[model samples]
Target: MFEKILIANRGEIACRIIRTARRMGIKTVAVFSDADANARHVRLADEAVHIGPAPARDSYLAIENIIAAAKRTDAQAIHPGYGFLSENEAFCRACAEAGIVFIGPPVEAIRAMGSKSEAKKLMEAAGVPLTPGYHGDDQSPERLLKEADAIGYPVLIKAAAGGGGKGMRRVDTREDFLAELASCQREALSAFGDAHVLIERYVVRPRHVEVQVFGDTHGTCVHLFERDCSVQRRHQKVLEEAPAPGLTGKRRGEMGRAALEAARAIKYVGAGTVEFILAPDGAFYFMEMNTRLQVEHPVTEMITGLDLVEWQLRVAAGEPLPLKQDQLAFRGHALEARIYAEDPSKGFLPSIGKLLFLSMPADGAHVRVDAGVDEGDVISPHYDPMIAKLIVWDETREKALSRMRAALADFQIAGVASNIGFLSRLVACGAFAQANLDTALIERESAVLFPPEAPPPDEVFFLAALTQILGEQGVKGCGRHDGWRLNGAFSRAMAFRCGEFENTVEATYLVEIYRFALGKRSVSARGRLTGKMIAAEFDGQHVQAVVVAACGALNIFLDGAAHKLEKLDPLDVAAEGGSGHGGLLAPMPGRIITLLVEPGEKVEKGAPLLILEAMKMEHKLTAPATGAVRAFYCVIDDQVAEGAELIDFEPETI
Candidate 1:
């Protein structure tokens, strides 16, 4: 076992590795960028080192800096925790040359599976089922179009070296092939520095199922069952479960065999994931293999009673497999939901801000939270926005799903927008509960999952009003002289805003009795404030709301949704909504990666204009309407703040 190991990643994965390393009596070293100077992982590690600036290229991806940090700390091994330099074959070779153990698969294995196209070819050669696609080495656009034509429409153009769905696009027709191909290749080049791609038939109603396999230096390889990750958005897995819901014992064994074979084919060592796209008819096709630990490995751990990170350490330390195939037994069903700092209402855009108030479900044997953030941590835009992984385990799938729903409801985060509400609705949906899942599940049930909650429930406004009233009194309980008109009703109006929604709430209180109105509707209630909680009764139903005031914003936790209210004066309505300007603003704080339009260029509505790289994803900004570009404020590689104007449009000539 390594006496000291350097974790070459940040956020949750780094913390996760540190936990396992500490438990195994190994000293852990953490490397952080400027943005993560006070990050949770840094605080957890035994020792921390400053690498470079916040940008991944300057810090996390700087091979020399990471290697130097490891050497300085006298780390015997470096664990590339999933993302930054985890799957880079060059990094593996570099570590070997530096006489430091790389706690992952060997360089040859990583190189073999790094390219999706090459991996598919290798899987085909090994008798693993493959979908109809083109994995040739031709680099011409014309050649790719021809291959797409042969593969038929609705084909997937995937970056040969891509993962996390960054450089993958599905084209439904030949007419859209070239444009989509260009965009796909551009993203691939920007993300992986590899523009080469492959074409495949996009499977419809496909369920993403991946097998967890680990190999030891002793040449022993075994599969730790599978995880169903069909619940996704934008080709990224949102939630995952182990012992895939609908698979029969026979099918599970067959898939496991195939996954183990795929691992053994390349003489793979350490933790790896072999992904497959399972069709509705029980057929499955090989997807690419991830050469490092997966984000959703907790579910696998919950089911198999194993610590995959500990297994990886043992394997990397020249130990044989912990348990053989016969000894491995999956005890129960487990589910994991990825909690992210994103707004589902805003097309799931990554949200960045401080975690003003953070609360999660209690962690125990059945419930686990692998998080890299604390209550005061700031979610920077420099990396992935995942806040934590909420994992639940139970004796049955039904119980597991039920526990997940309750757990999601219990998860609370403020300041930054989150998808906790969306996730709660998703797990409780009839289709999801029934295990009828697909990659398009989120889209198919979009209406119900993202139900509009604007002009929040009357109860919400009532609670907000009560909070303001009690807050003004500076007293938790009502007193004889509480500033309320003892003779008649005392009415006070409050102007408030929550994101793009604003409302005026009027509350009239006489002692403990209160009546609140928003617009015209009024709710009669008797309420009392105790600490930060308000207990109220309306229409013979008791309701309680918890309010946490922070950073000039009142966060009301009710019905599993955090309703943020900002107090304003009635006369300030004029300054509420900003002037409508004819310009393109950066949706979030990110670096400009591509400029698709030049000044004075005429573009149609919804035309691709530029791309912003943030939260490890590339988001393309488009023209709002038909217009001519008037000016450009940002160029390629310029890091801009949120709402920074990036482009100006010429006024429409009526």
Candidate 2:
């Protein structure tokens, strides 16, 4: 084994590599940008290096800084832990020229598989099953349009070097193709610095499944089963599982062989993934090859009981393949959920801020958490918004899913808005439960998920007011102290807003917490001014809670978790930039960088509502249902506070 290796990446993957490297008795070097100066990975590594500024291009992607840091630390090898410079052919070549081992596939392999266009051509020549489309060298818009027309009206415009669903667009009509193609190109150039693209037949009801293959310099290679990444949103995977639920033994064998054959054709070494888009017709088409570790690799690792990163290092060190293809076995089922700092209600826009109350679900032998942030840490706009990847394993797929749902409910974060609530609802959807889901699952069911106006349960607000009054109980006696007043001051009027609508809560705190007129729910809670918690006893069950600040904005901690609610201002004037509610609301607090919509415009339900640049990715807010834009509430350069209403729907005709 190498003496030391520098992790040329940041966040959870960097932390993941360091753990395995440590187990192998190897010293690890962690590189950090300004935003990640106090990151978990930096603290865990044996030594750390300050690379550059907070921006990824200046820091994580800077080859010179990375090389200098590696040499200064006397590191023998550099592990490009997925993303950043992970698949950059120039970086791999630079490592070779600098006399430092790059713990990945050879530079030749990286270059051959880096560009999707070239990779498609290479794979076709190697006789790998490919989707019928255009993967040519032409960059002319006219030529690309002609190719798309020749292929079909419904075609996929994909970036030559794309992942994470960036720089990808699907067109269903000829008129839309030209416009969407241009948009895809612009996004592609911005994301990958590559304007090249290819068109493919968009598979209807597609299932994204990939094979994990590994090779060594000794000319040995093996395939480690496959992972079903069918559950996706915006063409990006939200959940992944090992041993594809509906795949038969024959289909699994065929995919495994095809993956191995593709690897052999490329003479690939180190860990690589061959992705395929499986259509409803029971036929599969090669999407492209990923020349580095995958974000969803944890699920595969759990099922196979193999340390893929350690294997990457061993293979890069010229070790022979540890196990043959047949030796690799799939044990129990494993599933992973990507926990992102995003708001599902606001079209899944990224959220950024301090993690005031960060808590991960408990971990055990079957559960694994690959996280990057902790409590009090700031989630800046300088990097990806993925807070963590939670993985669960069990003897059966259903068992794993059951464990995951329970864990998700227990997972908590206070300051920033997250997709936990949305994800919880998605996995529980009827179609998802039956596993009859596809790529269009999210889009088809988006209306139900992203309701135009969320119904504010007045009961919940009433409960909050009642809970608030109980929390203000200042009785001196400690044990079961109810608000027993010698004097008769029973009712306290308070204002609160659910979203745009305002409500006045008349709370009576005479005996137990009670609502006005509505008979006392007879709720009693006792909390001390100190750190002790309070619980409401009702029907032999306790609603455990903690109240932090005894002030105007009620900072509350309910059900062993904390949250904030401001005192609603009934007299506050509504801002002109938007309706009281409608268009696109800021899911969580974030600044708006660009505007994509205007008033009196006709927009498809899924049209770009606006471009909210946050948590590092541009979240394109789309229409909820096809409607004419009556109003826009935000400006182009507005700094939108979280949950600030940005659009308004026309009043319904009676």
Candidate 3:
């Protein structure tokens, strides 16, 4: 076993590695960029090293810096926790040359499976079922189009070296093929530094099922069962589960055998995942193999009661397999939901900001939370926006689903937008609860998941009002003041902006109760503020809620959803709107990748104006209406901040 190991990644995965390392009595070293100087992983590690600037290219992906950090800390091994440098063959060789163990598969194995196209060819040779497509080394646009046409419409163009949903696009028609191909290539080069791509027949209603396979130095490889990652958006997984629901014992054993074949094919060592796309027709095709640990490995852990990180450490230390195939046993079903700093309503765009308040569900026998950021930490745009992995286990899949929904409801986040509410609705959705899952589940169930915003319940406003009243009275050092007066009860009106309209609620404090009236509706409410928590009642209905006041707004969390209501100041003048009228602002901090329209060019509504690359994904800024481009505020390759004007436009008169 290694006396010490350096984690060559940041955020939750690095923190996760450290916890297991500490338990095993191995000292852990963490490397951080400028953005992660005070990150939780840094605080948790036994030793920390300053790597480089915030940009990943200058820090996390800078292979030399990571190697040097490991050497400086006297780390016997470096664990490339999932993302950066984890599957890079060059990084593996660099570690070898530096005389430091790389806690992953061999360099030869990485080289064999690093590219999707190469991996497909290898899998085909090994008799692993493969989807029909083009994995040839044809780089010409004309060649790719021909291949797409041959493979039929609605084919998937994937970056040969891409993972995590980056550099992938599905083209449904020949008219859109070339344009989509160009966009895909650009993202691939930007993300993976490789412009090569492969074409595949996009499986319809396919369920993403991947097998967790582990190999040791003794050439012993075994499967740890499978996880269903079909609950996804934009080709990225949102929720995952182990012992994929609805798979028969025969199918499970088949997938397990196939996964072992993939591992043994490369003489693979350490932890790796063999992903497959299961068609609705009961057939499965090989997807790409992830050379390192997956983001959703926790579900596998929960089911098998195994620590995958520890397994990786042991394998990297040249230990034999922990257990043979039959000895390995799994008892129950497990589910994991990825909590991200993103807004589902805003097309799931990344939401970056400080975490003003965060309340996670308590970890117990049935639930666990693997998190990297704490309250007050910023979700910088420099890396992936995943907040945490919420995992739950139960005796059966149905119970696990029920547990997950409840756990999601217990989650609370403020400041940055989160997918907690969306996740709650998703797990409770009929299709999901019934296990009718697929890659298009999010789209198919979009109506229920992204329901139009409606006014919050009256109790929410009452709680907010009560919380404020209690706070103000506390400041005045008045305890138990029941608004006793000579003749009348003390009363005041509070105005709050809910959604788009301002609502005023009149409150009168009398005796030990408070009466609230809003328009024709009224309710008597009284509540006590206890450390950001409120135990309140409205019209004889008891309720519990959490209210957080930050960013000039009151965030009320109740019934598994967060509602933001801004308290209106009666004496304050309203600020004028239209500050960026006739302009398209950058939604987040990113670099302009392409200019789709030239200045003075006329375009129709929904026309793509330009592409902004942020958080390792591409966001297209489009024309708000039929308009002529007035000017280009930021050119291609220009780095722009969030809300910076990217283009100036003038809408045409009707």
Candidate 4:
């Protein structure tokens, strides 16, 4: 085995690889950018080296920097954990030339399966079940549109070299085909430097299922069963489970055989995933193969009781295949949730900042977490926003779903927006539980999953009320929320805690408390609690639910598992909710990359005033009307906290 390995990615996957490397008694090296200097992955590795600045082009994607870091750390191998360089054939070849092993599939397999169009042609030649589509090399838009017309109105335009929903678009009609095609090609060009696209029949309500295949240098390949990743949003998998719930025995065998054949067609080595779109008629069509480890690989490991990372290392070290296809036995069901730092209401935009509070669930024999973050870890805009992967295993699918719901409720995070509420409801919904839904489930019912919270202003006022009472009543703000019956009776006391301190307060039912603090004095605050939530005042201004509870917990409830205390209490109470001019500005947690205006600069209504890059995307805060910039408080590249003023404008004269 290699004594030292360099992880060539960031975030959870890099951290995940380092963890397994440690257990195997191998030394691990981590490479990072300026933005990731304080990131979790760097902290956990045995050694770390600065590669470059934040942008992926300058850092994570720079093959020279990665090779240099590996050489400097004396790493015998480079593990391109998922994203950046993991599937780049040239990177793999470079490593081979450098005499450093690349801990993944051989370069030949990467180049063969990297392009969706070529991979489809190769699969057809190899006699694997193929999807009906156009994988030709013609770059002319006119030619591609004609192919789509022949295929039918509904077709999927996917990047020849894309993954993770970046360069994929679905067209429902011929009229929209041209526009969507251009968009897809543009995204593909920017994201992958390849604008080649292919068209495939858009399977209605498609269930994304993939078989995990592993091969060794000794020429043996085996299947670790499959993962059903139908629960998704924006073409990205949100919830994944192994041993597809409704899969027939014959279908499972078919999928396994197809996956192994696909691997053999390319002489694949190391771990890879062969994805397929399962249809309602029990038929499946080939999708592209993931050349590196998958984010959802934990589910496969849970059912098979195998460490895929370990298998990858063993295979790369020239070890023969340890298990045969027949020896692999899948027992029970396993589910995995991709917990992300994103706002479900705001179109799932990535969220970033310090993790003020975090409580991870205990991992027993059957539970596993492939996370690289710690409580104090800062989620920077420099990388993917996934906080962690919480996986559960049980003997039955129903049990796995129930366990997942409960686990999501118990999982806690603060200081930034997240999709915990969105994920919890998704797993518990009848559609998901029934396992009959597909890719369109989220799109057709997008509004259902992220129903608008009551108006933000109303929530804001309610929080202000709670904070006022909390200040006046000490630990007994409960009285403000409790109502007397017509006969004047009935009250209960809730014990509120601030870290190690706890206080009991008297109140009527459903007056949810947010935070209670006892210093020289005590303060308590509550918001209306209802429907599996304790809606509370957060941060003295924003009204939000801090804790989402088990739906059953409503029947026998105390405090909700989600906490709202910290967002509500500022260290300097006097500084809470300072003045704002009523236009959306950076709330409190990012940097202003550029000030697009100056004082006295006239702009049209809703025109861009400044662009803020937070969570790795640029957001333009616009002018409310045709007005002049009366004041400006930020400069280009200013590190402004949330709520920092960027531009203030005066109403335009008629």
Candidate 5:
């Protein structure tokens, strides 16, 4: 094994690589940008190097800086851990020129497989089955439109050099083709620095299944089964499982062989994934090849009992394949849920803030957590908003799923919005449990997945009020004579704002029980706090929840959902309610990519007013109602904070 290897990435994948490298008796060097100066990966590695600024182009994606860091530390190899420059051909070539081993595939493979259009032609030549589409080099908008018409409606415009759902859009009609194409190109250029795209037939009901294949320099290759990544949103995977459910042995073998063939065709080395789109009729077509470790590799690791990162290192060091194809066996079913600092209720926009309180399910032989953040860690907008990956394993898929549901419910975070509750609901849905999954599963089950938004139970708000008063007066001293009269009860009023709505809660507290009224509804609850947890009995039902008070808000986690109640005074509530005037605000912290309306320009309701690029996705801010742009506060290329006013609109008269 190499003495020292530099991890050319950040966040969870970098930390993940460091753990495996340290276990193999190898020292690891972590490179970080200014944004990740105090990140977990930096703390975990044996040594760390300052790369550049917070922006990825100045840091993680800077090939020269990474190579220089490796050479300065005298590291023998560089492990590009699945993002940024992991699949960049220039990074691999630079590593070779710097005399450092690149713990991944060769530059030829990376370049050959980098462009989707070119890769399709190569795959076709290699006899790999491809979906019918246009993989040509015509970059003109008119040509693409003609190609789309030729292919058919409901086509997918995919960036030639895209992954992780970036730079992809589905066009259902010719009228929407040009606009969608422009959006795809802009995102593609921003993400991969490549604006070229290819048109393909959008598979309506296909399952995203990928094969885990490994190759060694000694000309040996093997496949480690498949993972079903069908449950997705915004074209990105939300949940993944190993040994794709319902696939027959014969079909599995065929997919594995095809994956091996794809690897062999490109002379691929190290760990790579060949993804496919499987139709309902049992037919599958090659989607694309990822030339590095996948984000969902843990599910494969859980099933096969193999360490893919270690395998990457071994293969990079010229070691033979660890195990032959015949020797490999999948042990059990496993599932992984990607925990992101995103609000599913808010169109899945990325949320940036400090993690006030973070608690995860206990890890055991059957459950594991691969996380990149800790309590009090700041989730910035400079990179991906992923908080962690929760993996669970069991003898069967049903057990694994059940375990995952329980694990998700146990996972908790505060000070930033998360999708834990949404994920829990998704896994518990009957369709998901029945394994009837596809890329459009989330959309098809939208009604159930995204239920009507209802305020947390009145009891929850009552608890929030009780906790706020108790915390202010000291929970320990509360039972003492702090607010209790001779009647052994004290009354208090707590005002709070939930999103845009405000409510005032009145409660009378006793030693271990409280009666509260909210919006004309009254309830009585018996609750006590033991260290940060509140155990309560309401409506003859017992419940326990984790609570954290920070940033003038009481964040409570009950039954897998996070509720934030801002403790506001009456004046603050009035100010908040009156602050809204038909102005466009930045939904999240991001740079203004484009402004569709100029000052004094008239726009219709729901018109695309501006585009904000954040968390590697472009979100359009539309007009709330038909209005005239009175003034502009931001322009293209300007970075703004979340909720900052971007436009001041004059509402049109009816």
Candidate 6:
């Protein structure tokens, strides 16, 4: 076993690797960028080293810096958690040349599976089932268009050297093929520095299932069953589970054997995953093999009761496989939900801000939380906006689903928008509850998952008002004791705003409860505030909630939903920025990649204006109405902050 190791990554995965290393009595070193100087992983590791600036290209992706850090810290091995340099073949070779162990598959395996085109060829030769597509090396646009025509409409153009849903496009018609291909090539070059692409026949109603396979240097390899990652958005997984809800025992065995074959074909060592696309007719085809640990590996761990990271360390140290296929035993069902700091209502845009308050479900035998940020940490735009991974396990799939719903309800976050509410609805939706899952499950159940917005219930406002009033009363020498007049019931008015609408609540102090009136409604309310938690009763009904005051607003969390209400100050006067005369502002902080319409150009309503790239995804800004471009506030490659004007336009008169 290695005495010491360095983790060449950050965030939850880095923290996760450190915990397992500590358990194994192995000292761990952590590498961080400027943005993660005080990150959780840095605080947890035995020793920390500064790598570079905030951008990944200058820091996490700097292989020489990471190699030097490992040597300076005297680390015997380097574990590239899951991203960054985890799958980089050059990094693996660098470790070997530097006399340091790379705790992953060999460079041969990574190279074999590095390119989607090459991986497909290997899988074809290994007798693994493959989907019908074109993986040829011809880069001519004419050749690609010809291939697309032969493959029929609705083909998927994927970057040959990409993962994580980047550099992928699904074209539904021949007319859109060339444009989508150009976009995919641009993204591929930007993300992976490889513009080569392949065309695959788009599979309809497919489920993404992958098998976890491991190997050792002693020529032994085994399987750890499979995980179903069918619930996705934009081809990225949102929820994952172990043992796959509807997979038959016979099919599971077949997949396990196929995965073992794929591993053995490449002489693979350490941890790797063989992903497949399962069609509705029970036929499965090879997608691509991930050369490193998967983000959703925790579900496999919860079911097997084995530390995969520990296994990686043992294998990298030239040890035999811990357990063979027959000895491996797994039970129960596990589910994982990726909690991200993005707003679901606004096209899932990334949200950045300081975490004023953070509360997650307590970890226990049935629940676990793998998080990277603390209460005061900032969710910078320079990295992925993931908040945490919430995993739950139970004896059966039904029970596990129930446990996940409860855990999500217990989560509370403030100062940044999150997908907690969207996840809560997704788990409870009828289609998901019944395990009718596919890649399009999110889009299929959009109605239930994203209901029409409605005004918050009266209880939300009541709770917010109560929390504010009670908090103010606790301040020494600043509270109004006159509300307790003995001669008569004290009366006061409290005003609040929710977006553009405002309301005032009238309160009369009585014996033990307060009578409140809002518009034409009246209710008697009483509540107790216990350190940001509230247990309240109104009109003979009981409710429990959490309230957080930050960013000049009162955030109320109740029953898995969050409501923001700003307290109105009558003596203050301030005007917010409204419509800027047909100007389009940046929705989030990002760099402009392309300007489709130049200044002084007339465009129709809904025409594309420019493309803004943020959080590793491209979003096209469009014209709000029939207008002519008057001026451009930002040029291509300019970094702009949230709400910064991007374009100014003049609308044509109706």
Candidates in order have lDDT scores of: 0.89, 0.79, 0.92, 0.77, 0.89, 0.91
Q: Candidate 1 residues 1-654, lDDT tens each?
A: 889999999999999999989999999999999999999999999999999999899999999999999999999999999877899999999999999999999999999999998899889999999999999999799999999999998899999999898888889999999988887887888778899999999999899999999999888889999999999987889999988998999999999999988999999999999999999999999989999999999999999989999999999999998998889899889999999999887678999999988999999988999998999999988889999999999999999988898888789888899989889889988889999999989999988898777666777767777777766677546663344674777777877877668788777776567777887787776767887778888756899877888888888899777788888788753646443338889989988988987889998888888888877677888888787888899988898999999998754444
Ranking by TM-score: 3, 6, 5, 1, 2, 4
Query: What is the lDDT for 159 in model 4?
Result: 90
Model 3 Cα lDDT, one tens digit per residue, 323-410: 9999998989999999999989878999999999999999999999999999999999999998999999999999999899899988
When sorted by lDDT, best at the front, the candidate numbers are 3, 6, 5, 1, 2, 4
lDDT of 6 by residue, 1-654 (tens): 999999999999999999899999999999999999999999999999999999898899999999999999999999999877899999999999999999999999999999999999999999999989999999888999999999987889999999888889989999999988988898888777789999999899889999999999999999999999999886778999998989999999999999999999999999999999999989999999998999999999999999899999999999898898899988999999999999887778889999999999999989999998888998998888998999999999999999999999988899999999999999999999999989989889989988987678788888877887678778889857426885889877888887556778888877778888888999999989999889999998999998888978989988778888998875566887655458789988888988998799999998999989887777788888997999999998999999999999888776
lDDT of 5 by residue, 433-494 (tens): 99998999999999999998777776667678767755655636445634568766788777
Number of residue pairs clashing in candidate 5, backbone atoms closer than 3 angstroms, sequence gap of 3 or more or interchain? 0
**lDDT of candidate 1 vs native?**
0.89
The per-residue C-alpha lDDT of model 4 at residue 303 equals: 89
**TM-score of each candidate?**
0.93, 0.87, 0.96, 0.77, 0.94, 0.96
Model 3 lDDT-worst window of ten: 475-484
User: Where in model 5 is the C-alpha error above 4 Å?
Assistant: 475-481, 486-490, 499-504, 509-514, 517-527, 537-542, 570-580, 598-605, 626-628, 651-654
Candidate 1 runs further than 4 Å off:
475-481, 485-489, 498-502, 517-531, 537-541, 573-581, 593-608, 623-632, 635-638, 649-654
Report clash pairs, candidate 4: 474-522, 539-567, 539-568, 547-562, 587-642, 587-643, 588-642, 588-643, 589-642
Best by lDDT: 3
Model 3 gets an lDDT of: 0.92
Worst 10 residues of 4 by lDDT: 549-558
The candidate 5 region of ten consecutive residues with least summed lDDT is 572-581
- Give the clashing residue pairs of candidate 5, or none: none
